[model samples]
Target chain A: MTDDIAVLGAGMHPWGKWGRRFVEYGVTAARSALSDAQLGWNDVQLVVGADTVRGGYPGHVAGAAFAQALGWQGARVTSVYAACASGAQAINTARAQILAGMADVALVVGADAAPKGFFAPAGGDRPDDPDWLRFRVLGATNPVYFGLYARRRMALYGDTPDDFAQVKVKNAAAGRANPHARYRKAVTAEEVAASPVVADPLRLLDICATSDGAAALVLSSMSFARRHGVDPVRIRAVSTVTPRYPRTTLDLPDFATDSAAVVAPPAIGFRASIAAAAYAEAGTGPADLDLAEVYDLSTALELEWYEDVGLCPAGEGVKLLREGATALGGRIPVNPSGGLASFGEAVPAQAISQVCELTWQLRGQAGGRQVAGARCGLSVNQGLFGHGSAVIAVR
Target chain B: MRTPVVAGWFNADDDPDGFRLLGTRCRMCGSVFFPRADAYCRNPSCAGSELDEVPLSRTGTVWSYTDGRYRPPAPYPGTPDAPWEPYTVVAVELAAERMVVLGQAAPGVTVADLAVGMAVEVVPGVLHQDAERTWTTWHWRPVGGPV
Candidate 1:
C-alpha cells in the first residue's frame, strides 16, 4: 500500500518481573530499537510513549520520561493512554506524525512495572468510575470475566477444559524458544490442570500474570526507509475503533453492557471489529495474513480471537484448535510469541510487543518460532473502556 | 437496617416483591443502564438527556456464571484476617432491558450450581458487615431458590 510506515526497528526489554522503574525498561528498549534501526537517539525527530498508570507520575508522561532517560534530545514528545491499547495508540501517533510530514523518524516506546496478583483499579470510593465500582461492589476480577467467557464457550460449543489447556501448551512451547518471554518452560495439559483455580473454569496458568516489561519500535516514512538504505517490514494499517453503541457483550471492569433495547446490536461484536477495520484499511482479508499475535489474556480468549480475527467462523474456534490450525507449523499460526500465556501482561507495552513479534516474523528473523515464508502478519488486542487495537504489518 | 455498599445500586428492602436492581432508562430511546446513567443516554443515535430511574426486571436468565476462587485485592472489602472464601458471580440477561447485569450469586451458590440460560432472580443480600454497618448489595439466585 502507498500509505505505509516502515518499521525500521523493533526491540524489547524482555517480559518479566524486573521490579525496576518503568522508565528504565523504556529507555533500554528504545536504545535497542535505535541500534537496530542503525540510527542514533539524536536522529529521532519524535518520541511517542504508551503510558502505564501503575508507574505514578513519571509513567503518565512516559514519552518525556524515556526522552529524559535517553539524555534528552529536543524531540517532539507525545504520551498516550488507552489501557492495554496504549502501545497501539503510541504507534499510531508516531505514524500520523511521520505521515503528516512533521517528522521523518519517530520512536515509539511502551513499558510497565505491573503490580503482582489480580490488577485492581485506582483506589477510592468513586462509584462513578466503573472500574472501581466493579471491584468494590461486585468483587469481579479480570479472571472472572475470562472465566465467564470460558464457561460460556464450553456450554455453547461443547469445548472442554482440555481444549483450553492445549492452548497454554502450544503457546508455552513457542515461548520456550522466545528469549524475551517471561516463562521459557514448555507446559503440559496436566500442569495446567494441576494449577489452582483463580476463577472457576480458569486456573492460575490459564490466566496471564501482571509483569514488568517494555517494547519499542523505530518507525519512519517509507521514503526515509529507502534513504536509510534498508528494506523493512512496514505497518500497512493500525485500527483503533470503539464499539458501536448498544454493545451487549460484557467486557472487563464493567458492571453491565450497553443495552441493545433501543437499537439493534451491531452486526460484528467489538472484538471482531478490531481486526475487520485493519483488513479493510489494508485492502486485504484474513487469507492474506501469514500469522497473527493476538492478546491471549486467557487461553480460551485466544480461541475467541481465532474467530474474532476471522481465522475461523464463530463457534468454530475450538474446531480449528482441534485441527491444530493455530499451532506453529499448522495453517496460520497464532501467538507465535508465546502470547500472554507465557509472557504474562505488561499492559502498556503489550500491543507494541505484539507488533514487535510481527515485525520479526515478517522479516524472517524470528529464529525458532518463525512462521516460515511469512510475509504479512497482524496483531490484535482490546483495552478496557471500549478501546479496540489491531495492526497489520507486511514486508 | 442494612446500608447499601453503594447507595442507589439496588433497593435494600427484604421483601422479595420490593427488591429490584435500580437502573435508569432513556425516555427518548428506551435504553437502560444498570449503574444508572442519570446524566445522559449512552445510545449514540439518540441524544436523550433525561434518564429516569427504573427498577430492572427482577427475574432474568443466566447469560454466564463464574466464581472468584481467590480473594480479590483491596477496595473489595474482603474480610480481614479470615481465610479467603470463594464466591460465585453471575451475569444475568434481563429480557425487558435487553442488557446483562452482573452481580454476586446468592450466598452459598457455587459455579457447579449455575448454567447458561438458567433462570435467576435478584435478591437483597449483604456484601460485607463492618462493626457498625451491614453493607448491602444485590445478588442473583436461581428462580426457585429460598428467598
Candidate 2:
C-alpha cells in the first residue's frame, strides 16, 4: 500500500450554466480551497489543473492558467486531460508529488464552462479521431452509447424503466440538499418518465447535462498536516487504470470493441478492475466503504457501478438498489452527494467533484446528505478513451 | 458523384455476400481489428506486425440497440436547415469474432423492430448527400425484414 496524502481542504464553485470562463470558476474554487486550508497561494508548492478542451488554447495549459489567475507564486505546475477522468488524474498527480517529497503542499483544480446541447468533436476533418469518426460516420452521440447500455441492462437483468427512474428519484432527492449541485429540485419517477426521450430506452433526465462547474482540493504531506496542527482526511489510493486489450463491452466514442479472437478476455472487466486496484492499494474491500461517489452520467450506469465496485454481485445491481442498499440512508450509501445526476457534468471537474464529496462525507461535513458516521468513501469514474479512475479516502 | 464516408472500411468489390466490413487480422495472433488496424497488433502479448486485410462476417446478432431521437451536432452531416429525423442504431455482436460493432440501422427500422439477441446483417447504405457526392456507409438490417 502507498503512503497516504492528507486532504487539507476541498471546495467548489456551485455547478450551473454560469456563462463565465472556466478559468474564473477554477480560480474561485482554488481560493475557497486555500481559505479552507488556511493557506495562501504562495504556500502551495505545486499546482495541477484538469484541462477542458472547450476553453481553447489556454485551457490546454490549465495548470499555468490557474496559477496565473491566482497571482502566480511561480509554483511548479502540470496539466492533465483524460476526458472525464481528468480530475481524478489531477488528484493522483498531487498525491504522487507529495508522496515523492517533491512538494509539501499541492493544489489540484478542475473546472469547465460547457457549451450548449450535445458535445461534438473539435472542428476539422480528422478521420483518425474516434470522437469525430463516431459522430461523423455513425451520428452516434454520447446518449446513444448510454442508451445502448441501458437497453442491454433491461434485456440482461430484467430492469425496467421504473427501475431506472428510481435512480434519478433517489439522487435528485439527495441533490436538493447539496448547495453546489446545479439541479437541486427533487425529481420524481413521474418526472423522469415524463421527460422526453433523447435516446431510446433512456429519457432526457436519464442522461446528465453539460454545465459550468469547478472543484478544487488542497493536498499536503502528512508532516505538513501535523505541523499545521490539522487532522486532515487522508486519500488512501488513486487508481488510474486503462482498459486491457480485447475489451468485450462496447464503450463510448468507439464504433466497435476489440476482438477477443487473438487473446482471452481478462477475468475482471475494465470497470471492476478499476475499483479492484483502488481497493487493493487502500487495503480495504468494498465492505469497508461507508459511502461511494460514482460517475452516474446516466441512471442505468450507476447500477452498473454497483456491481463494478463489488457492492453486489454482477447483474444484481438492480436488486441491491431495490432493497434501498445504495440510497442515502442505506447501509452503504452511494452518491449521497447526489452524483452527476445532480451536478450534471463539467467534464474535467466532475471526477474531482466526486473526490470533494467523498472528502466532505469522510469529514462529517456533508450537511443533510451526510452518510451517517461516514469514515471511508470511494469515488469511481471512467473517462473517454480507455481511462478509468477510482479513489479511496478515509478519515 | 458518390463516395464512401471513410474509405477502406467496407468492401467495394462486387462479392456475392454483398458489402462486408473490412478489417485487418494479425498474422501471428489472429486478432481481428475493425476500422482496420494497419499498424502493430493491439494484443499486449504479441509484438507481431504482419497484418492481413480480411472481410468480416456479414451477419451478427443484435447485442443492443438505440435511437437518436434528437439531432446530432456538426460533423454528422445532418443538414441544419432540415428537420431532424431520428435514426435507430444497433450494436451487433459477431459470435466468431466475439466483438460488438456499432452501426446505423437500415432506414425504417425503429426501436420497436429490434430486440437483443436478434439476428442482423450488414448492408451498404447512404449516410448523407451533398450536391456533388453521396456518402456511403454500412447499416445493420434485421434478417428477414422488409428493406
- Which candidate tops DockQ? 2
User: What are the per-residue Cα lDDT tens digits for candidate 2 across B31-141?
Assistant: 999979888988898897999999889999999999999889979996788888899999999998889999999999999999999999998888998898988888899
Q: Can you tell me the DockQ of model 1?
A: 0.86
TM-score of model number 2 = 0.99
Q: What does the lDDT read for residue B51 in candidate 1? A: 85
Query: A272-326, model 2: which lDDT tens digit per residue?
Result: 9999999999999999999999899999999999999999998999999999999
Cα lDDT tens digits, model 1, B25-120, are 889988888788888888887789998889999999999999998888778985757998889999999997899989999998888888899999
lDDT of 1 by residue, A1-395 (tens): 33999999999999999878899999889999999999999999999989888763643588888888898879999999999999999999999899999999999999999988889988767877888888888889999999999999998898988999999999999999899999999899999999998888999999999999999999999999999999999999999999888888899888888888778999999999999999999999999998999999999999999999999999999888889888899999999999999899999999999999999999888999999999999999998988979999998
DockQ of all candidates, in order?
0.86, 0.90
Cα error of candidate 1 at position A200, Å? 0.7
- The candidate 1 chain A region of ten consecutive residues with least summed lDDT is A52-61
TM-score of chain B for predicted candidate 1: 0.94
